[model samples]
Target: MTSRFTELSVDCHDPERLAAFWCEVFDFKVIDRSEDSVEIGSWVPTVEEVRARQMPTTLVFVQVPEGKAVKNRLHLDVSPIDASTEDEVIRLLGLGATRTDVGQGPDRSWVVMADPEGNEFCVVRSLASQD
Candidate 1:
């Protein structure tokens, strides 16, 4: 079988702060934490579940000495489950996210935003609002 996309590791200056911000962004729970890292997802899975690839993808924030210096080559694209894109963007802003420009011009459907740690991501229109 092919490998599963299980976890995304992010290097940051403060794991706890980034973890907290992301958890609020996605309503994720902190499944695990260590001295230099924090893992957040929808739930805490057992080793068996993880090995079987039955767990949802999780984000792991690790402490690093260097700060983010350039635009992200890879980023996450998210849609709100129960809100309009504008509302979701407003909510994310309230949670400490700031709008960012990565050459995404005014006509694009997705809005670019940066997390507290300066990682760029997108908020796209929800399916519920499209029809």
Candidate 2:
């Protein structure tokens, strides 16, 4: 059998804040919440048993050490799910992502941006445009 990605958890100082930020970024919803964490998902899992047994698929933002350096070895590369690249960039910026310069020039392509926790991500041009 082949392995598949069930979730993408991010370590942050504030889980709720990060979760909220990602929720807006991906248009995901808070399907579950606790004192220390929240679970945001694109699909709505039915039944409590199903939700619990379904691998807890979510982008969990857990609390971490303070003064953590802004160096993420693994970051997400998000593309517009249903909107244009420009629109997606605007939405992400409004959701708290800041434009960052990772030495990539205009010729290199992709809009480089950082999350609230200083994690760098790229927003490339729409896939539809390539086709």
Candidate 3:
């Protein structure tokens, strides 16, 4: 059987804080939450309706006791939906994200950044800018 990509589960020390941070970063809302986990997603008409339509994936943050000790082997790369990457990067920086260096050379096409919890993700050039 074939499988479709769905949720991305992240292990963090603070689920609530990380979930909130990701929600702000993606313009998503917390759809489900528990004592040790939070799931955030873009709003759709209804859960069943959205599921039937195969909505986009959501991010689930789970609380863990330990902090990040190394670089993420699988990290996210985000591009602007309506604005330039520069503007988005500036806004993200204002939201507590910090620029990070992960051995990517200066000539890289994307800018690597770390979240409040030191999870590394990239901000790539916007589609409009590439066009």
Candidate 4:
């Protein structure tokens, strides 16, 4: 049997702040928190929803003393569900994300950005625009 993907853990200087930033990005809610870690997750899917594969992996942020010094080796690629790509970028920017360049030149389809603590992620075309 194959194992299922359930959660993604992130190391950050401030788990609360980082978790808050990601919550807005993913439209998730903080489900759990502790002294050194925070967990944010989307709505829990029902059995039918699970059968349809509607759930997404939850994100966990843990506090680390060291700051981010190098580019992220693993990053998230997210797509807008409610707005156009450009509009989503604007919204994200308004929510404390900053546009960042990571050698993904202008011709690429994705817009690279970083969260409050400089974790890199990408904004691609909305899923609705895929057709």
Candidate 5:
């Protein structure tokens, strides 16, 4: 049987703040919080809401003493639901993301950026605008 994807965990120096950054990025809300970790996901109005019906995986930020030493081998690529790629990139930059160069060169279709904690992710054209 194939395994289903559920959560993506990120190690950071500050779980709460990092989680908050990601929450704003994805319009997600905190699902769980602990001393060393915080989990964020798409908004769920009630406890009885069926998590099995959720569209995407949850993000978890775990506190660690060490900082990120190298580039992420696996990174997220996000498409704006309502904004253009350039607008979304600008918005993210305002929220503490900084542009990064991962050797994608000058002709890439996506913009690469790093979070407050230095994890790289991409902003791409939305599916509706891709046609």
Candidate 6:
């Protein structure tokens, strides 16, 4: 059998806050919650057990210790699901992400930004727009 990806789990300091931030960024909903953990999924679970078993296919956030240090390699790139790159960039910036200057010139393609937790990601021009 072929392997199928289930979710991209992130170890964060605050699950609820990060989930909320991501919810605004991706228009995702909080499908389930607990005292120490919260799971954000694209689709809502119909039942408790379903929620427990539900794993988001695209991305998921899990709470971790406060003192954990992120190495110099953590990052995630996101593409607009339904909106144009420009629109998505505007939406993400409004959600709390701040632009970072990583030595890439202003005219260099792609918009680079950092999430609330300081993880960097890029939004590239849409494929549809390149055609």
TM-score of each: 0.91, 0.77, 0.88, 0.87, 0.87, 0.70
Q: At residue 39, give the lDDT of candidate 1.
A: 98
Q: List model 5 lDDT by residue over 1-131, tens digit each.
A: 33446789999999999898998999899999999999999853342343444456789899989999988999999999887888899999999999999888989889999999999999988654444
For model 4, residues 11-81, the per-residue Cα lDDT tens digits are 99899998988998888999888999999998653556655663788899999889999999999998998
Compute the lDDT for candidate 4: 0.88
Question: What lDDT score belongs to each candidate, Candidate 1 first?
Answer: 0.92, 0.78, 0.88, 0.88, 0.87, 0.73
In candidate 3, the residue pairs with backbone N, CA or C atoms under 3 Å apart (3 or more residues apart, or in different chains) clash, namely none
User: Using alpha carbons, what is the TM-score of model 2?
Assistant: 0.77
For candidate 1, lDDT tens digit of each residue in 1-131?
65667899999999999999999999998999999999999977676777776568999999999999999999999999888999999999999999999998899999999999999999987855455
Please give the clash total of every predicted structure, in order.
0, 0, 0, 0, 0, 0
Q: Which candidate number would show the highest TM-score if scored against the true structure?
A: 1
Task: Give stretches of model 4 more than 4 Å off.
Answer: 44-55, 129-131
Sorted on TM-score, best first, the list reads: 1, 3, 5, 4, 2, 6
| Residue-by-residue lDDT tens digits, candidate 2, 4-70 | 4566777778888888898888778987777777778887656554545555456877677774575
Instruction: State the lDDT at 24 in candidate 2.
Output: 86
- Model 3: ten consecutive residues of lowest lDDT: 43-52
lDDT string for model 3 (1-131, tens) is 43445689999999899888989999999989999999999963365665566668889999988989999999999988877888889999988899999999899878999999999999998866455
List residue ranges in candidate 6 displaced over 4 A. Answer: 44-58, 67-74, 81-84, 102-106, 127-131
Candidates sorted by lDDT, descending order?
1, 3, 4, 5, 2, 6
Tell me each candidate's RMSD, in Å, in order.
Answer: 1.7, 3.9, 2.4, 3.1, 2.9, 4.7
